[model samples]
Target: MDRPALLAALRARVGRLERAGAAAALARSQAGVVHLSEDIDAHLPQGGLARAGLHEVLAAEPGAAAGFAAVILGRTGGPVLWIGPDPDAWPSGLVRYGLSPAELVLVRAPRPADGLWAMEEALRCAAVGGALLALSDIDLTAARRLQLAAEAGGALGLLLRPDTEEAGPSAALTRWRVDALAGSGGSAHSLGDPRWQLDLLRGRGSTPRSWTVAWRTTTDRLETEGGTLAAPTRNRRRA
Candidate 1:
């Protein structure tokens, strides 16, 4: 081979090796956990949320659940994919949750099957940081597929569903119920920061717990009253 040709081939081979090394490192994390925040990390068995796993969020109110999911993804550090039957893509509200609409990709799938398909495909993309699906219901098989896809891509997967007294089991690593809480402010007329009651109904190797928290826009941090990552205000037994 000519000198230039050999050099070019060596460069190409080096590039492939670098990519492989990155994938290997990510695969290790896929098999482990991701440190989300100090508040909730210690409570989890893996010391954090599973990096490449599906998590279910039962929405006491759709808006609150959606907000919480966005907050989680904002810390994930990459482009986010949001899929739903019908999505209200309001840019203004997303900024408060720390997601830039410019970096968010929204997919609308009117049919349930289509939405599920989109979610799986998005989750399997290596470049995507996170994927959120506002699903009405998810079965075990479908949930497992999502879990596998997340592992393949090393991305966070979130399923947002309506809260119910009886929610069927799924392949999700954790299940959280988010309820909107009344905001506090100096005056009743002035709007306060958003607040929510977060209930960790179930998580692999973790007991059920709850927290009442608020997002402070001034500091751009979500914290309990004492400026902690998460303060457990209550604990509940699984039904």
Candidate 2:
């Protein structure tokens, strides 16, 4: 082959090798667990929520209950199945959080037990990307079963309960107590107000953390505050 042609062939071969090496490195980087980070890293374990299998959030009040579930479902970005005690009154804010109204499948059960069962089935469906199950109350056994189903389907599960239901054993990967805080509106840079404060209660391989997050319904974004709570505290007595 001509000298110029030989040199060109050699350069192309070197470029291909370099690209292959880069791809290999990228694959290795992604092989491990990947947590989702939405601007607030310090408040979360490793700067993101663990995306491994199952996670739970328990709210201390009705507002917090609905808002926390919405935040978790919003982050999944997949088809969500919400099973509630009553079909008539579904949490409207969930739709505002970017969960498509069409993407959400609401199943209303006459009783809390039936609702839990329906939620388990929904999470088991491969077609379902994620699920948020809101119950008036769920016993420890029911929670454990739901957790198992979530793990099997590789779907994220959130159990929203009243403050009274917080006492019990749970199979959830993590339990978060969420509260709605008064928020101020102004320039975007300043941490306007405390929209929601989340307290992580339990998780394997990770310590608890607290976060101050703002939910902008119009923008469909959850902005993490520049600051987090001073210490992790559990209001189990109240819940």
Candidate 3:
């Protein structure tokens, strides 16, 4: 193999070894990192969300994936710019997930092509804390463009793609597939806080895994059941 290819392989091996220790992972998470729960953090090499990185989200159903994105934005604790074909953002609906409509800036593009353009431009703005781009189609080239822009501006960029969009190739730091599930509302008469089936399909320096988590409206936190199975606990805070 060439020298560069040999170095890349060595780096990948080192990353795997670093993520194998649970105790070391826990320490990194506690030291000013975003808490995604112990189980989830253990699987991530960084033990938390990568700052100023691009993440791609896909859903079996449309609205379900968007809800999960709201959870991420809430944790980001910054203003969000959503660029899509329509203004589907409902401030009241997003409150349960932690993002208030007041913190949102909606930009409606006439077409998917236009939305992609707007997404890159928005990521270049320093004032924009986070950005979500809803596009029906994006190739590897386009995806890399968005990624570079986000890295330059030091912001998080969420590429919201359709369920049919095959997860083939991309430059995103992480790729997630989110699906909503029905759950007990605590009481018989009402629906409970939104529950979702989250799949980490791909991430740099991490293994792919799945988990079920629910949004707790009262505290604006992601309630997980220890990891993959157990009962929900409300101790974790979103921020």
| Top TM-score prediction, candidate number | 1
Error (Å) of candidate 3 at residue 148 is 0.5
TM-score of model number 2: 0.71
- Using TM-score, rank the candidates from best to worst: 1, 3, 2
RMSD of each predicted structure: 9.0, 15.1, 13.3
Two-way lDDT contest, 1 vs 2, winner: 1
Give the per-residue lDDT digits (tens) of candidate 3, residues 1-239. 44355346534533443355334333432343344556777777888766567888886667778888887766655567787889688878877777888668777776777687777866754445578998777888988998899777556789888766355777999888777778648666888778877777778987667788777777776776546633223332110
Q: After superposition, how far is residue 17 of candidate 1 from its true place, in Å?
A: 21
> Residue 23 of model 3: what lDDT?
47
The alpha-carbon lDDT assigned to residue 101 of candidate 1 equals 83
Predicted model with the maximum lDDT: 1
Better of 1 and 3 by TM-score: 1
Provide the overall lDDT of each model, using Cα atoms, as 2-decimal numbers.
0.74, 0.60, 0.70
TM-score for each candidate, following the candidate numbering: 0.80, 0.71, 0.77
Give the runs in model 3 whose Cα sits over 4 Å from its true position. Answer: 1-35, 186-188, 229-239
Q: Which runs of model 1 end up more than 4 angstroms from their true locations?
A: 1-37, 226-239
Q: Of the pair 1 and 3, which is ahead by lDDT?
A: 1
